[model samples]
Target: MDCDLICNFKKCRKRLNANAWVSIRKDIFCDDDGSREFNKSTTCPACQTSLSGTYDIIRVDLQQSEKYKTMVLAGQKPETVIDIASRALAFWTYQITQERTYQEFVTNKGKERNIQMEQYYEQILARTAAELTALKTQLAATKKELESVKKKYTEATEQILDKGRQYQKLQMLYDALRRKCITPLTFDMGDAPVHMPNRNPSNFDLTLSTRDSILRRENNVSVSTTVPRSPAEREFLLTPGPTPLPPTISDECPAAQSRFHLHIETPNRAMSRPH
Candidate 1:
């Protein structure tokens, strides 16, 4: 009952009452973990101090100690032994109680450290998870913006190509007219609503005149026509009636069953605006 030694490691709950290790610092530990720690560093684990080799720690046998103590006190007088016994018994009793108090202090310190460590790790984890979620949202938004820009780029490219083709066609038409290779397609100035010649005009026979002041003064014709070399031109030559849409004319140009639009160079109107 006098001995109540235990391992100094706060986490270890092993008893060292029978046989144990005692360091110069008076720190006590159990046989198993104590020996292992000593061999690993040859240092005191509790104080974090260097040890002066194996002399710093000593193996103690409590049963042998008590037997030896009794033997040494045996040879003395009964009264002398009795008086020394009282003081020695009290010393050992208080020493054992002090060791228990120190164990409780170490255990409490270990618990507080564990709690603080858990709190710190939880805060770090929550912060990291939030950052990960924000990054994912940003990536999704970036992808959407990229797709929108790509769609607008494709539409602009198509519009540019359409305009280029229209310009080339106008250039070729102008060269042919200036050379006098094309004959004028006649129109009725009388009550007839400007008859488009019934026959499909050949390349040399197709002609266009403008409604603008300059062309009006030069030629006696008032109405202008855009005669394409394609079959769509003959469709216009048909007498006024219901007409079907042509594949050649697209969303770029608007057309009605009896009328179509053309881009002609003039002082005011370079191209017709879409309705």
Candidate 2:
């Protein structure tokens, strides 16, 4: 099936198993292209050799052995010519064998690269699975911690509500006692009425809203607008912290509760006032 004897012409690559035209320069051509080229010029188409009357372009049968084959094998020439022909045949055979081997090597190299690519993909897949498992475990732990914080917040809310109810009941009792002090009820056993002790012993009210309403307010100090021109105004009361700023001037200042509020440039200490 393979065309071992093909036309040597560049444009005519057809098989020439039956008969072919051969030039003296060893150029082979098919019947149709060769006849056209020969008629067009007496010179050889391939090498430009003069082909006048002699059979420079001869027709040969490839299927049958030619008469020239006997002349070449009968050692019609010197031994050096035979050796040169043998060397040329050996070089052509070696080149053909190497070409077949190189094609198989390339094919095997492509298959090896495909296998390596598959192995790299599998490694990436396994790493992704491991990372996903760790993330899922971290998410579960976060959910558990969130539930614990929710339970603690709920318990604290209930405690605050109970304390607020207790404070409201104590405030109602204090208000009733203070009102009783204002209006006296006496026993008429004695001629002179006896005075009861004042119910509000602290003097100032517990709530700041009651005292704030009694005092007249003044404009607040705007730190951004106030520019210090004098040395005394510019002088800052530098205190080592973490202490707080000074308490504002009020009617209830220097009271038992004022010790907790007025703390600028003062060291940390408990109230020295009597309980």
Candidate 3:
């Protein structure tokens, strides 16, 4: 049969050091030496009863025992167990504290760096915005100026074109006037009559000649005189024919003629004219 027991022993040496019968019984019967028998008789150390079945053994170590003793001793105000164990615990505690401190410092520094970077980025964005605004303003002004210049240029070009056209028109008029002024005049007249000087007379005589008489007269050399006859005969023979009038006269007319005659003649001759 199997016997089961539940017991807590601090250490193997602690059980040995108790020196009590009960403690020895607990160590010898419940520890490594304990056993359960079903067909044979296994008696209890104190009561001399058969051991129970299905017993369990529990073991402990010196380190845990010493640790508990030190805890207890420290509570009881003893300094004997204050050794490497306490030092190790203190070292672990200090390490954890230092780690927390470093972590906090690193976190604060990261936050500060992030804040500085944000500020720098904000400044850069502001400067870029200002520059962009300035550029846009300049571009607008330039565009306006370009439009003004283009308008002026168009006006000037139109003015130049107009002047050029006017100059061409004036030049054509001048050329036409010059051609008219420089052209020479030509006259043509057929044979008509020749007048004798000082031929004006109220009456004169004339003779009619036939073709036979003209032939006889051509053969003869004789001077003949005629008597004064009728007015018709005189007018037909010796009357001064009407002087031909000038076909065209200048608009300046009398003044221009007078001046021309004055220049051509002597002063006495010009003064002798009728007023």
Candidate 1 weakest ten by summed lDDT: 185-194
Model 1 TM-score, 2 decimals: 0.40
The whole-model lDDT of each prediction reads: 0.62, 0.59, 0.48
Decide which is better by lDDT, 1 or 3: 1
Question: What's model 2's TM-score?
Answer: 0.33
Instruction: Give candidate 3 misplaced runs (Cα > 4 Å).
Output: 1-86, 185-275
lDDT of 3 at 140: 100
Each model's TM-score? 0.40, 0.33, 0.38
- Of models 1 and 2, which has the larger TM-score? 1
Checking candidate 2 for backbone clashes, the offending pairs are: none
lDDT of 2 by residue, 1-275 (tens): 23355555556666676776777555667888788888898677656777775766787766766776666457556687778688645644543454456557878998999899899999999999999999999999999999999999999999899999767755655554345333242122223322324434442234444334333221122223344343332342334565333456566654423423422321111222222
TM-score for candidate 3: 0.38
lDDT of 3 by residue, 97-174 (tens): 644665589899999999999999999999999999999999999999999999999999999999998787666656
**How does residue 194 of candidate 1 score in lDDT?**
31
Best by TM-score: 1
Clashes of each: 0, 0, 11
